[model samples]
Target: MSKSNDAISQLTEKLPILLIEDDITIRRFVEINLKRSGFQVMAADSGETGLSLMENRRPALVVLDVMLPGIDGYQVCSQIRDRFPEVAVLMLTALSQDLDKVMGFEFGADDYLVKPFNPLELVARIRAILRRFNKDSGSLLCSGSFRCDLRAQQLFMDEREIELTPQEFRLIKVFLEHRGQALSRDDLLNLAWGEDFVGDPKTVDVHVRRLREKIGNAPSTGRIETVWGSGYRWREGS
Candidate 1:
């Protein structure tokens, strides 16, 4: 066998997901659909079981419903963010309120979608999140106690995982790849969101703020410094 082929085999790993929804119908539907789409899924009808699965299973991402019996989604999301910072969370809610969105974001949800959601849309959202995260730098990256697992798309501080949203994960990947250089909001838009994205560049600012909050001093720069007139840069050294 070719050396590269052997190396690839050695590194390949499965990306599993967890779904926490109280409704039996939705849970089975999502679980089956996720499996059909080639993702290994772990399903739970309660937040307690979901948390239990998370501890034992260590899923890479979670599809969580906001409304659930016992320990609601918001609190569960909070707990997940606090305990497993590396696991990505996608919040499912029935409410279309801006307040609901704000609450989810504040509680560390990576993505939020309304109920009666399209199965395909949920699949697509999951794919997008994983795609952003799946970019392996081809080597383990580190600065201080923080380590980046390129293969798994997970960040760890002193071995504890640090959760990051898909956008935030992409942002860090971009920054690390361009370390020592100042990246303007536009540059970030192109790199992180891709040139195809027609959204405003100001959105980059929001994700950056969120990323900084989660990664904290783990960044080589100790902080993502504001570039004043230009944008932001993940400078090396504190």
Candidate 2:
């Protein structure tokens, strides 16, 4: 362990993080940066070591590199998601293609970052994810058996918790905030993915379908209403 790791271990008493990357230079750079940003960082040089640490320490979040020596980041992320669903995984890699990002999400990564990344920006992203996860876990909003707590970024039905991706959470929030009002696909694109994001409206439709599958279990009187020609709306009472 390096001196920075020692400092991080002491300073980040409650903010445990697992960093899995094969590059020594990059790992050192990230470890130092994370320590400066107030995160207790545990590093692994390979996916196998990362998994062993994960089984033992169970960090609050994982910063994983997709191109690892053994097993690969996707396999590691899938294993983590299957075994420890609450732990958040953020994929940090050199692969920046849209397909790579989609693959990371499919493998259960919470966020994806292309490498040669800015150190300060990485810190900021980590903070935002942690803040969202912490907030969602502690509070919930209820309307009948359906519940959504913006803090936890979670939804529930009949007291049963539902898992939602970050994109799904943003979409649901937009609908809930403007309940009963029709929102166009463009409106959702701006709200969920930001005005600068260049993606087709069909992305919103795909996310909505996933959200409905998770939260729309009851038959009829659905929570989300689809308009024939326009967009969609959240029903006030359904």
Which candidate tops TM-score?
2
Residue 42, candidate 1: Cα error in Å is 2.0
lDDT of 2 by residue, 1-238 (tens): 6985455444444578999999999999999999886788999999899989988888888999999987999999888876777787888979767777777766767676888989987876676566545433355555546677776667767678777655567677778777778999999877766664444566666667767777773533348878869999877654
> Listing every candidate in turn, what is its Cα RMSD in Å to the true structure after a full C-alpha superposition?
5.5, 6.5
Cα lDDT computed for each candidate against the true fold: 0.77, 0.76
For model 2, the stretches where C-alpha displacement exceeds 4 angstroms are 1-14, 136-139, 149-155, 163-178, 182-209, 216-221, 225-232
TM-score of each: 0.70, 0.71
* TM-score attained by model 2: 0.71
